[model samples]
Target: MLDILIKQVKVLDGTGNPGFIADVGVVKGKIQEVGFITRKAKLVIDGNGLCVSPGFIDPHAHDEGCPFFDEAVLNKLSQGVTTDISGNCGQSLAPVSERYWKENQSVHALINPPECMHEFTSFGKFLDAVEKKKIGVNMGFLVGHAALRIAVMGLENREPSLAELEQMKVYLRESLEQGALGLSAGLLYPPGSIAKQDEFVELCKVIKEKNAIFTIHIRDEGDYVIESVKEAIEIAKRSGAFVNISHHKAIGKKNWGKVNTTLKMIEEANQDGLNVGFDQYPYNANCTYLNTILPPSYLVREREQLVMNLRESQFRERVKEDILACREKWDNFVVNVGFAGMLVIKADKTPDAVGKTVSEYANALQKDPFDTALDLLVDNHLDVIAVYFSMSDDDVETVMKNPYGMVGTDGIYMKNKEKTHPRVSASFPRVLGRYVREKKVLQLEEAIRKMTSLPAQRLHLKNKGLIKEDFDADLVVFNANTIMDNADFIVDSYAPNTGIRYVIVAGEVALKDNLYTHAASGQVIRRKEF
Candidate 1:
């Protein structure tokens, strides 16, 4: 007898092979049988004609402690995601001091949910808390280099002292030993961007020794994008560690079509004995806090100096110049200031803001976009912003078709919102529904493989990302023909995916018959410590 059984399902198996009609049985959270299963169970689901595959895995995300801890999880589950790799972009809620939380509230608010646990001192403690809390989805984390730097150097974007470097290495080694998959660096973001190559190399060496991986959000996303990627390659080469280019993209019109050259470089690196891959979102525009796009030097000074500069004439003039360049060269860099500036699909803000554009609010206020952005930044102390732009559909398609690429939403699973990137709610389904079903960019098996087995392999999980006997019963069932992503950029941002009928995490049905049960059965997944 099995704990549960699915009857007459079309199985994709997460291996990119042809699907076959079969019955699957689960026992004690692991797959007991697949193919012809003559078994009895406590629960049996009639899965006739429904597709069963290993649960999807999101490769890059930052939904650590967003508005509510489980706010946006439904969207992900409805799209068949049983696991996700968050704590991305060199950030995480754990291994953080209470003082750091208070001081960095500005950047942390956008992604950190209220239930975020901070009682952990080391990576092991963080994992322990997750297990105790029973977090949603199987969670793997990247030890953020910036977080470590801030823990030691107080957000100073400079090379660490020899003593400070040693302290960071100790923490890095501890995290890897405790189950962190690897280290992630956000080179374009502050603190991380300030780290010199020598400073980063020292940390990467420690990661290599721990038998882990290194992922990076390169230093530049504009004209210097290639050079930035090259820097990441250089790090991997010198460190002798596996590398993943986080959310690989060339933002703005000027950087379009450069992906070909970028892919070439990645292939060259692969030939050079370094395992390299990248993750990408389907849409074109990007989102982050309002402060990220500010002039680099504006953030270099102390916080007191930062506030003073905002009020200074010289700083204002420099800001005006930078705004002009952004508008001229990067006009698509729209402002999503405060709750009212853009739609609030995931936050606990008023419903009116969720789908409205920043331009709409600025027009009502009779102010320039840049001025409006500045005003909001000042009001919120530059806490957060969400921007949208026109990314070439061709570029998105090309990246998805690449053999080395995987999918990510870059958005969180917030439910009570009006305006939001459909990616938050639609990324996975859109891939299966739009790209694979409608556009036929890739085969269904190939797409499923990209979402499941590939990511599992990258993270090096021992029992996850497969649908074989004795493997964890993290599975999804959906109808390929009826699948559709209901979220859109300009409208209906909170709409759910259409075809996912059930999602099983660790043999528990988290989403059943297209509705979420709010089951908090997921555990923190750590790396194997050798």
Candidate 2:
């Protein structure tokens, strides 16, 4: 007897193998049988004309706080993502300290964790709360280096003292003991920006000891991308921890095609006995805080102080000079992509600014584009989301073709938002539709492997990424011929994709006929003993 059964589905078993016709049986939340199943079941699906593969695993996700608002995280589930490796880019919702809450509350808000999370002081407590919410997809998290720094020392721009460093290590070790998958460093953002290489190496030592992974959003993705890649590799070498680069891309026009060099570097490192890999979104553009256009010094300041600095004439001139100079000290988004390339997607105080480029908005206001961007940030409490059209399509394809590469959404979601990166709701299907099916950039099986087994191997989830008997029953069924991503940059960015027919999590049907079943069958995937 089976709890649920599917008959005559074409199975792509997440191993980069050709598809085969088979029947799959599920019982007790695990895959019970495959290949010509003759079983009785409570629920049966005629899987004809559909391909069933292991449910996609999002290797790099930013959904750590999304469950607080929408426990189902329907946007991701709708895309066939059964598991999310969140707490990437050095931001998590837990291990909150009174100092962090008091001084760095705005920074904390960037991850969008609920205010009540501040009351809990440990990563385990936060995970417990999320589990209690009965989320719709399994979630694994990494202890965020920035959160750790803020917890011990609030937004300080210098290296930690030895005692302070040990405290961070203690917090990290405790989090790992309590089920954190690993540690993630957003070196592109502060206090992660302030951290020196030694800080990462020391923290990664803890990660290595715990048999966990280290994921980093490197310091620079523009002019200094090669150096940043080297930096990540060196950290892995020093700490002997597996390092995964988050949302890997080469931004800016002149910096296009740098991924070729970086990918070679990653391969060389791996060949030399260093574990290094990367996750990438399919799009050429990237999204982040609007204030990233300013220098790193301004980013570390409090919201009010940053707004005051922006308002001052002398400070504004100096800031303009720095951005215009295109100094390589940090990633200067404005100089790289230009105001026309930066579009405001979310500006709560200035709704008119949403969906308009900084240049376009500036023209309408008869103001300098830089000033207009500054005003939006100020008007919105320094929390504006913008998408930058910076990468090359060629580079996007090149990275996609890499054998060591995997897929990630790097999707930023806001509750009750009218717009977001299409990757939030369409990454998996877009890969299948545009890249695999339309462009033939990758074979269907290989793309599924990247989304499934490869990331599962990285996260060390032994059971979730394959379709073998006795594995967890997380699967996706879709029509290969009609699968396509409809989400676009200008219109209906949040529209659900087509061709995803059924999504099952832990033997429970969470999505059927492209609609959510509102099932809460997902579990909190903790660190496993290797």
Candidate 3:
């Protein structure tokens, strides 16, 4: 008898292989059989002719901020995600310190900020805590450059001294040695904005020495997108770093077709024997703090100085002038598309502001959209999250079809039904439902591979991406015909998908019929360092 037997399912082995009917046996937390199985089991689940594939791996997730806040990561589990790669866009959860608490108060408080941010001091300690806590899904991480930079030096906008740079390298090397799979840089974010190309190459050198990957939120996704791509590729080439671009997108209407040029550049880089890839969520919109729209120069000062500048009329006039004089040449998305592109999804102190666009709020207040945005940021102390309806469906699909492209939420793990981007709950299933099933943009097998093996390979997880006999029994069984995402804008963003029948983490059932079993069976996925 087996621990569990899932019988008569169409198995998509997650290798981009055609689906075939098979029975799978699970025992002692790993797949014991993958073909013909006649033995009885302690528990048997008739798959009801559903499709079983390896559990999806989300390559970009911000849930690492405080995994426990997600309450079993129900949103992700319902969508078939079993492993999440966090520590993205220059923000990670570990190597915590008081300065991190101060610098990130607004960002942290916005998402159910964890009370224990200061407890964990190193990557290893953080992973240990995660294991002890027993989170709901597997986790992998990249030590973020922004966090490390702050840890070593305050959020100053200047080149690191030779000693300071070496200290940063030491911290990164320690993180990689202690199970971090890679290094990530949010070059567009403050503190990260100070990183010059020479600095990136130097950091990538440390990452390359450990044979780990380097993932970057490139400096610009709008006007300077092409140049940013060239710089990212250059860092990879010069440092011998295996790099992945995070949440790839072209953010403005004018830049709608730029991904074509970016993809070609990445392809040619691969041809030159360099490893490069990108991940994208299937939404035409993006979510980030409202302060991100401000010039990085304005944020380079101390926190007190930043607050003073926001209140000063002269500074406001300067910002207003820049906003109006904006050419598409700047990285500020507000200037690129104007304030109308920003839609407030969550504003805790001002709950009434949720579900409204900046333009709408501005019009209601009879103020310029720029001033309304600035006032809100000042009132909230820069703690606001919004969605940018900046990308085109055509551009999103074009990037999605690329062979090197994998899926990532670039989304937060929301615990509420508050107006959040639907990608939070529906990204993977949306791909299956809207893109794969309805639109036929990609075959079912191909889409599964992108969500599974492609991300596993990128993270260097040898055992987690496929449904082989000896692999861990992390799997999802769902109805192909009925399977589709039900989440949408605002209220329905919390709605679960329609077809996920069962989710298995380590051979035990975690979700049966889209309801979480509250099983803390997840493990911290660490790098296999030599």
Candidate 4:
């Protein structure tokens, strides 16, 4: 007898194919059968008028520490995401050297608070902790370049010494052996920003040797975006590792349609036999550290020193000058999008600044916008979250239409009443409702394919992307007609999406009737040798 059975559901199958009426049977933790199944089971779901497809796979996620702290991973499970590829954007919580742990604590705090920092000292230990925690969503991770660098070099701006480089390679190889899917670099952030292309090529050699992938949040997303894409392609070509671009976009008004050129470049690279693709969240705005508006020159300093610099009149003017000058040295968010486009979503110390744009907050305080932003950073100990409205609708659609494009939430989780970008909760549903159903930008099957099979295939998760016999029984049952994202920029950022009827992970009903079942059926998806 089957453990669970769904009757008369329209199975989309996760391929770019039209849905068909069928019954699916699940036994143990795998799909037992698909077709006209007359299996008897303990729990049977009448999937009439519901569309069942392979559970969504988030190709780029930042929920590495969610399993340890919140095992349910409600934000992901509620959106029908059964699997998350965490450790994206060069941030993972593991493999910390005891010596550098204190200095690197601030970085890890972005994922987990200080109290939880001692839980994992190595990549293997982190994975083990997640496994023991028994999360509600399957998770795979890429070893972060920043974590590796900090472990060995402690936020040094200079290139690694030969011995230090070897040590990083050792950590990366050990991480792969212990189950990391690949290496991810956030070149836009430091210490990743400090490293050069040569350094990445060397690290990717280790990735290639292990048959793993290399994913990157490139060095720039505005003005220099084309150059950044070229740099990623160069890394892929030189290292022979599969490269996936994280949250690909052309930010700023002037760079609105640059994706046309960048996509063509990626396609040409693929045609030349280089392995490359990109993932994008279905939103125009992006969320990140408020200080990213400042140039990288300002970011390399320690938090206290940075705050000191922000408080200094001379240094503050220089920083503001650099931002307003639109220097090509880094992606200048302030100059590209202007103060009006930078919205403060989270600032614990400056509660009044929350829900206000930098410009608005500055006006209320009767101060300059740059000073208001700098003061917020100083008051908040250099920890603040802001949303930048910087991408074009046409560019977003263009990337989505590409055959190589896949979906990722790039979602940042917030605690208590802290606000986050709506993409964290509304990405997948928004894509289905607004783009696929309402705007007719893509068919349901194609959109589902991008969300499911494409990402799984890219990450080489052989058993999880498709609805086939003997595959992992991770599934989602949703009302296509009623599905829509309710979360928005200002009013509601954490509101759960609508029409996600059921979410099954590892053959267990983790979410039923639009409510999380709190089932801890998820497992760690470690890397397997090709």
Candidate 5:
């Protein structure tokens, strides 16, 4: 007898193949059988003409801290995500350094979550704590370079000393040995920005030696984006590391079609057999901390010191100039897209500012948008979160059409927020409904494959992201005709996807009939060590 059985379902198989009518059986938390199923089960679900595909895997995310919170990834599960790759953008929960531990509260509130950090001194210990949380979806991790820097250098802007370099390599090797899939670098962000090209090449060499992957968020997405891409490609080529470019986009209106050239470069790299590709969100807008709009140097200090730096007249003038430039200079998204393109989505002590742009707020205050943004940063002490309307929908569609491109929410764990980007709750379903069903950009099977096998292969999860026998019984059952993402950008951001009847993570139903069953049965997936 099986643990649970689904009868008369159209199976998509998650291999980019055509669908076939079949029955699936699950037992002992694994997929037991597919095709004709005449066996008995403890629980039976009639698919009612729904499609059953392997669970969707998110290739880029920062939900590593979800385990500490009570909500525990309800937003991701609601979107049919059964697994996600977290510790993205050069941030991880494990391998905490003594300096980072002390400065964590003031320096990085986003990455440090729970009292669990004290119990773990290494990557293995952190994964142990994550397993104890039993989150709603399987999670794979990538050790972050910023975390290592904080542990060793404590936010310094200089290159590591020889000893410091060796220490970071040891940390990376240890984490990879303990099941970290790869190394993630956010060079545009602090701590990681301190690393030079030679530094990155050395770290990539370590990753390559361990038979792991290297994922990077480039130093710039506008203005100097091509130079940034060259830096990343050079690191990969020199070290022979498998590379994944995270959230690949050409920001700014002039840079709208730049992804065309970037994608060509990626293809050329692959043709030369350097193993390079990118993952992207399917939305026209982007989300990040408001402090990013400030000059990178102004953000290097601690919270209060950083605020003081922002208050300096000279720094403020530099910021104004950077935000108004339109050439190959500093990477400023606000200047490139214009202030009208930016809207605040999250901030401190400013609930009314949530849905309005800096320009709108500027007009109301009778100031320029640059001054408006500066005042908000000072008022909120650089804790604001905003959305940037930077990318073109055509570019988003074009990137998705690439055979090497895969889907990722880049969304994190959040619930019951007053205002948020629709991508947080709508990425997977939006792809199915808008891109696949409505626009015919991709076949349903091809879309499912991107969400499944491709990401699994990228992360090297042998037992996940497929519907084959003996695979984990993580699955999604949804109606193709009626399935759609209801979350909107201006309003109703928390609206769940429509036509998803059930979501199974490891043979247990996490979402059934539009409600959580409180059956969180997920595990932390680790890479195979050399």
Candidate 6:
């Protein structure tokens, strides 16, 4: 007898193979059989006409530190995500001193930042705590290089000495040995961004030694985009480490059509004996703080210095220069608001400003958009907000078809039913539903591979992203044609997808009939270091 059995289902086994009719049996939290199963079970699911595939894995996400105040992860489970990798862009809730957590009150208060932030030093300890807590979804992590930088060297902009670099390497090695999937660096953000190529190579060497991967948010994704990508590829070559570029994109209008160029470079690198991969959310616009367009020079100084620059009489002139540089390169900088498509969501403390665009707010207060952005940052004290600008839909389609690419949600699992970017709640569904079903950019089987098997291979997850017998029983069942994401950027747009009937994590049903049981059966997925 099996623990659970699903009868009369079409299995899309997640190996890029054709689907076939079969009855799958599960026992002891593992798939025991996949063909015709003549077995009795404790529970049985009639999966007639439904499509079953290996659980989808999000290669990039930001749900690590704390649960969103809204319990909308069901939005994810309903669309078939079983595992998610967080700690991207060198940010997570970890490797902190108590003083640090207390000082960074905003992240802690809202993210409900975990105890692991203060208790752990090595990546192994972090994983141990997650297992102990049994968080929602299976999680894999990259020991954020920014966190390590702050741990050793405070949030200062000085170059590390030989001794400091060696210390960082020691920490990286400890993390990999303890089971970090790889090393992640956000070269577009402070501290880590200021790090030179030699500094990055030193850190990546530890990842290489453990046979883990190195993922990076490139230094620049706008005017200097190509150069920044070249730098990352060079680091991979010098260190001999597998590289995963996080949310690969050329952000602004001037650089809008460069996707093919970037893809070609990546393909050529693959031919050059480099193990390279990338993940992207299927959207044209990106969400981040409005200040992301500023060059590195603007952020080189301390926060106080940044404020001083903003307030000084000569600063406006300098700001004008920077803005002109941006304007020349990009045709239009849309200050998107709620209905305008670039919505403002997730400013937890203040909700009044939720639906207003930069232009709208600026006009109401009689200020320029640039000035308005700085004032908003000061008012919010550096809290993050979402930005949705227009990206060519064609670009989204072209990138999704790339062989080395996979999918991820750059934001958290949201459930407020308010105006927000669709990526937060609709990424997977939009792909499996709209893109694959409506447009036919990819076959259902191929899309599942990108969302599951491809990511599993990139992260080196064991016995997952497949429907093979003896593998862990993480799975999803849905009506492919009926599946559609209802989440949108308009009012009350947080509704879950349709047609996804069940989601199982480690043989336990976390979602049944599209409703989550609030069961936290997930484990911390760590790389096995030999």
TM-score (all chains, Cα) for each model: 0.90, 0.98, 0.96, 0.98, 0.96, 0.91
> Please, what are the lDDT tens digits per residue for candidate 4 over residues 415-519?
652588988878999999999999888899999999999988888897989999999999999999989999887898888789998999999999986687778
* Greater-TM-score candidate between 3 and 4: 4
For candidate 3, the 10 contiguous residues with the lowest summed lDDT are 104-113
> Which of 5 and 6 is the better model by lDDT?
5
Residue-level lDDT tens digits of model 6 in 1-530:
88889999999998888899999898987999999988899989999989999898987876665343433344456668888787788765556544444333222233345543567655666677676664666777777787677767666678899998897788778777777777888787666667889999888887778888888888867666688778888998999989888888776666777878888889999999987788989778777654444555565566666765666658757765766655322212331122244355655555555767766666777777666666665566556365666566787888889988998877654434445566766788888888899999988999899988898888889989999989989999899989888876556456677888888888888888778777777777878855
TM-score for candidate 2: 0.98
lDDT of each: 0.73, 0.89, 0.83, 0.89, 0.83, 0.73
Put down candidate 1 lDDT per residue, 301-331, tens digits, no spaces.
6656666667765777788777546532222
**What is the clash tally of candidate 6?**
0
The residue-level lDDT of candidate 2 at 72 comes to: 89
RMSD of each: 3.5, 1.1, 1.8, 1.2, 1.8, 3.2
Cα lDDT over the full model 3:
0.83
- Candidate 2, 140-186: lDDT as tens digits: 88888888899999987788999999999999999998889999989
Query: Candidate 1 vs candidate 3: which has greater TM-score?
Result: 3
What lDDT is reached at residue 122 by model 5? 90
